[model samples]
Target: MTMRAWVIKQYGKPEDLVLDRIPVPSLREGGAEPVDTLVKIEAVGLNFADEIAIAGRYQDRIEPPFVPGNEFAGTVVQTSGSSRFQIGDRVACQVRSGAFAEYCAVPSHRLMAIGDLPAPIAAALPVSYTTAHVALFQKANLTAGQTILIHAAAGGLGIAATQLARSAGARIIATAGSEDKRRIARENGAEHVIDYRQPDWHDEVKALAPQGVDIILDPVGGQTSERSLRLLGWRGQLLVCGFASGEIPALKANYMLVKSASVHGVYWSFDRNPEEIATIQQDLVGRCADGKISPLIQQVRPISELIEAIKDLGTRNTVGKVVLAW
Candidate 1:
């Protein structure tokens, strides 16, 4: 059967993607893989990484004439022989790419039931929340009662990190690019919010944490990386999540040695056993179901406006997750 999808003929800008009709994929002959699940997508999540993928700058490069999306929520129309889920189940999942379509074939291991939550919200969960959990609990070793400085606290990644850290009983100092964003950060459990545009923003953070913050979650990598180092107490850890600034920053080995601190690079897309990913998805799904975590969707655009939605993300005009809904 023919299906509608946004196809990327080349990699340059969001407008470069074109809507086209394509054939629906069938399960493999004989039998489908035990891990495969076919879903009719209802919503797709947009990320900064999507823009990077389209620009051919992502760590994992993609060839042109491809689909560009990583997270999606949908209803399972065909089961790939996995008894864990049946046809007509509502699910959400994260994949390497190819989610910008009417349907997607995801591994059953990555699929999680969304319960009664809207599909768009479910679509926003996997990538952002999983990345936050891994970065805070696994990489940075965040502990209760610690101080955490979450940069870009109003963006998708920042919001996830803020909520998770707050739930862990950490003191949250959130930094945003504007007052509106700062307000959103404060509403999401941030104890303090500062506009990073000011010249003395670091001083404000220092004033709050006093000695220094125990953990720093930094997705904005340019000068923010350099400033975050100064706010780290002895033996503090700086989690480098991404370079959303377009200018990648570097840390000096000598400086780290002087402060007795460490800089950790967080790459959430690391290869792992399907079971491991499923476990994380399960935790995230439970939290969403309990309303412990609510994704702050900045905008929900129609599928036909996919290009415009991507452009808004590229310009940083959005405060939270931007979703393209069917």
Candidate 2:
């Protein structure tokens, strides 16, 4: 059987993505490490990292002629003999690649039951929310009454962090480039929202926090990352999520020395601790089930429009998570 997929014949631009028919993956083909489940993908969430991977700039590089996607929602159509999931189970999965297809062979460990959540929303949850949960609680240990500054505050990861921080009883100061985006940040949970495009944005943050924030969630790098250091309170932590600004920033050790600040690089994919992953998964799933947290989907397009969808995301023309429904 064949499945339609977007394949990157070569690394370049979103325009370079090719829609092609490929044989559906099977669990039986797993040489040494067998895939546990075969998921018939229903929806796929688009991330900034998807574009990076397509352009050959991501940290984990894949050779040409590969699929470029990280997170998806689907139904289990097949499973290995020892798999925990049965056929017909609704699931959301996170993978390094192969999500931009009609069917994806996934390991049981990467699969989370979707329960009653919508497929697109469930697809959006695994990556952004998982990263936010780990970054805020595991790495930073954000506490109640603490203050956190979340940059790109209207995007997927930003909004996830905001909701999670609010649930933890932390005060949120969020930054986005425009008023509309800033409004989204406020709606999500931000106590204060600032336009980071302003030259004096850091000043605005300082004005809000006064003595500086307890934690800074920085996905927007470039000067934003460097300037965030000035807003860290004593023993404050700066969680380095990703460089969505396209320019990586250099931090000064002198600033860290004065504030006794710490910088933690948060790469959720590198987290191999099964117990920790299970804990975060359970917490996020429960929150979603209770309607305490919800993913904000900016747009949902057909899988055929993947290029246009990705282009909109790359240009920052959309907010929150973007999903391609198959």
Candidate 3:
């Protein structure tokens, strides 16, 4: 059978995405590992990573003529006999690619039962929230009463970090490029928000947190990453999440030496520490179900408008998560 999908014939920009019909994927194709569940995709959460993948700049690069989405929600229509999930179960899943299509073949291990959580919201949880939880607790070991500075505080990952930090009893200092975005940070439990676009934004952060923040979650790289090093307290940690700013910073080792601080690169991969990831996923899913934390969705558009939706994400014109309903 055929399915409609946005195919990238070549790596370029969002405008280069092409809507095309392709065969529905099976459990094993092109020698890929067998995926145990087949899902009729209901919603997809768009990330800046999608844009990065489209431009051929993402860390895990894929060749052309490939689907470009990674996180989604769907109902299971097919499953291997030994699969834990039965047909008709609703699930949230993450894949390396192929989420932009109407149907997706997911490895059962990457699938999480989402219960009654709305599709868009379920789709929004896996990537951003997982990254936030892992970075804050697993990597940084953020403690109660500690201070955290989250960059791009209005973006999906930023908002997730803010919410998680707040729940952990950490004081939050969020940074955004605009006033509206800054306000979003505050609404999502940030104790203070700074206009990161200003030249002396780090100074402002220092003023709010004289002892330096205990943790810095930096998704906006380049100068923002460099400046964040100076904002760390004694033994502070800077968690490098992504380079949304398009420029990777060359951090100075001297800053770490002076503050006795550490730098950690945070990236979520299914291949590493399966048990730990599953534990994190289960916790996050339960939190979402119980309303302990909410995924902030800025807009929900039809999948047909994927290009426009992704363009807004790329331009930094969006706040929180953007979902595409299929």
Candidate 4:
């Protein structure tokens, strides 16, 4: 059988993703063979990382002629004998690749049950939500009543952090690039929103949280990284998530010595156990169902427009997550 997929034939631009009909993956499993679970993809989540991978800028190595998506949601169609998931189960998961296809052969361990949530919501949950959860709850140990500053407050990760922080009872200060994004951030439970593109953005953050923010979730790591440290209260944490600003900022150790502040780097995908991811996924699903948190979907297009959708994400013109529905 044949399936349609967005293949990365060569690393260049978003348009380099070529749609091609490829054979459906086999469910064969044995010793030394990967345990595969076949899923008919219903939705695929797009991230800034997708643009990085396509442009050959990501630190991870990617060979051409491979699929370039990280997260997906679908129904299980077939499974290898070693798998616990049965056919027809609704699920979502993040893979190293192979998600931008009509069907994906994901390993059984990475699969997370989506319960009754829609496919687009499930697809948007994995990477962004996981990153936010781990950064706030695990790394920073954010507590209720504390203040948090979320950079890029209108982007996928920023929106996730804003919602999670609000659920935790933390006072949120969200920084976006535009007024529309600021409004979106505020609607997502951010108590304070600032236009980060303005020169006096951090001034607003300072006035809002006079005691200094207890935590800062920074994905834009250029000048924002260094500036975020100034906003941190004593013993506060500046969680380093990514360098979306195209420059990685450096800090001096002496500054931390005086302020007693620490910089924690959060790499959500590293050293993660499948069981933990499953638990996080379940929690996020519950939150979504209860309306405590939501997957902010900015656009949903057909799988054939995958390239154009990716291009839109690359331009950083959209708010929240961009999804491709099959």
Candidate 5:
């Protein structure tokens, strides 16, 4: 069977995401059953993880000439398994690879049933929403009515975290990059939005949370992370998610000691913490269905413009989730 997938001919730039036709993969000995599933790919969500794979940056290295996407939403047109799903089930799945395709096989276990939300929303949820869910609810143990701050507040995961935290009754203090991002952040439930590009954003945050935020969700690294501690409240928890800013930040040891603040790291690799993943998903999935956390999808560019979308995200221009359509 013919399978259409976005192939990275060589890891370098978004231009390298070339559309190509390849053979549909069949069941391997260890792979799950329902081998013949046909996913009419409706939407493919982009992640900073994919950008790293494309530019040869991600720590989880993959060989060239492979599918680059990690998540997608589609209707399962065919499946051999009858226990969990019927022929037509609209679902969003988390996978290590193979989502950027006209048809992809999702091991039933990795597939999570989506609600009546549109495919675009469902497609956007799997990665960002799940990651945000893990960061806020699982790792940080955020309580309702408390306050938290999110970096990259208008990006895919940022918006998800903002909405998720807001639904939990936490006052969201969002940090964005531009005016557009600022608007998106506020609309999504940020009690206050600070543009980090400003010279004294740290002061702005300090002014808002004189006592410091209870939780700090940081993906931007380098100096940004170092300065964030100044805004931490007593016993505040800093959740270190990534280095999207392209620099690793070093914190002053005194900051941790004096404030009784703690920092935690997150590496959403499949090798660790399977059960934690389930609980996070169940919570956010329910919230999404109830319209508690609405996704802010900025654009739905076709797979052909993969390069453009990647560049937009790299420059921090995309307002929210940018998806690739099959």
Candidate 6:
């Protein structure tokens, strides 16, 4: 059967995306044959990385005629060689590509069941929320009553980290670019929000947490990580999530020795240890199920507007997770 997809005809702008008919990707088990299990994508999540991909500036990643999405939520349409996902089971998955299409394939192992949450929320969780979960709880060893400073606190991972930190009983001090973003952070449980676009954003962060935060979750990188070290409490930790700011920062050794603070590099892509991810996923699922931690989705649009949505992400104009539905 034919499927509609947002094909990246060339890497440039939203206007460059070409919607076209494409073959539905086949499901494969053991790499042998097309299996019956089919994933009908219901929603796709957009991130700043998709924007970078569109402009041919996505870090070490190369250009695209490639589909730009990474995460999606879908329902099973068929099944073979996989009993775990029954027909019609609702699942969310992370993939290198293919989610922009009407249909995609998901190995039973990659599927995460989301009982009642909408596809938009499910699509938003796998990558961005997982990064936040990995950084705060797994990498930084977040514990109750700790104080944390989250850069880009209204962006995808930022909002996730804010919610996750608060759920873990960590006092949240967040940094955003504007008043609207600051309001979003506050609504998502950030105790303090600073306008990081200002030269004294870190100063404001320090003022709020005078003793300094125990952990700083920095994805902006470069100068962000460099300057954030100054606000670390005694024996605090800096969790390096990504270099979304386009600059990777190097640190002075003396800075580490002075505060006895440690820098942790958290690569969610590398945290592919399934057992560990399963455990954390379960933790997240339980909390989410109980409504203790919510999937705070802020924007939803159709896949037809996917390109425009991605461009909006590049402008950093979005708050919380931005998702596109079928």
Q: What would the per-residue lDDT of candidate 3 be over residues 101-141, giving only the tens digit for each residue?
A: 99998778778999888999999988999999999999998
lDDT of 3 at 204: 94
What would the per-residue lDDT of candidate 6 be over residues 199-241, giving only the tens digit for each residue? 9888787778888789999988989999998889889999988
The best-first sequence of candidates by lDDT reads 2, 3, 4, 1, 5, 6
Which stretch of 10 consecutive residues in model 5 shows the poorest summed lDDT? 27-36
Residue 232 displacement (Å), model 4: 1.0
Better of 3 and 6 by TM-score: 3
TM-score of 6: 0.91
RMSD in angstroms, candidate 5? 2.1
Model 1 residue runs over 4 Å out of place are: 29-35
Question: How would you encode candidate 5's per-residue C-alpha lDDT over 108-178 as one tens digit per residue?
Answer: 65666786768888888878888888888778888988889999998888998898888789998889977
RMSD from true fold, candidate 2: 1.4
Candidate 6 colliding pairs: 37-78
Per-prediction tally of clashes: 0, 0, 0, 0, 1, 1
Q: List the residue pairs that clash in candidate 1.
A: none
RMSD of each: 1.8, 1.4, 1.6, 1.6, 2.1, 2.4
Candidate 2, residue 123: lDDT: 92
TM-score of each: 0.96, 0.97, 0.97, 0.95, 0.93, 0.91
**TM match of model 4 to true structure:** 0.95
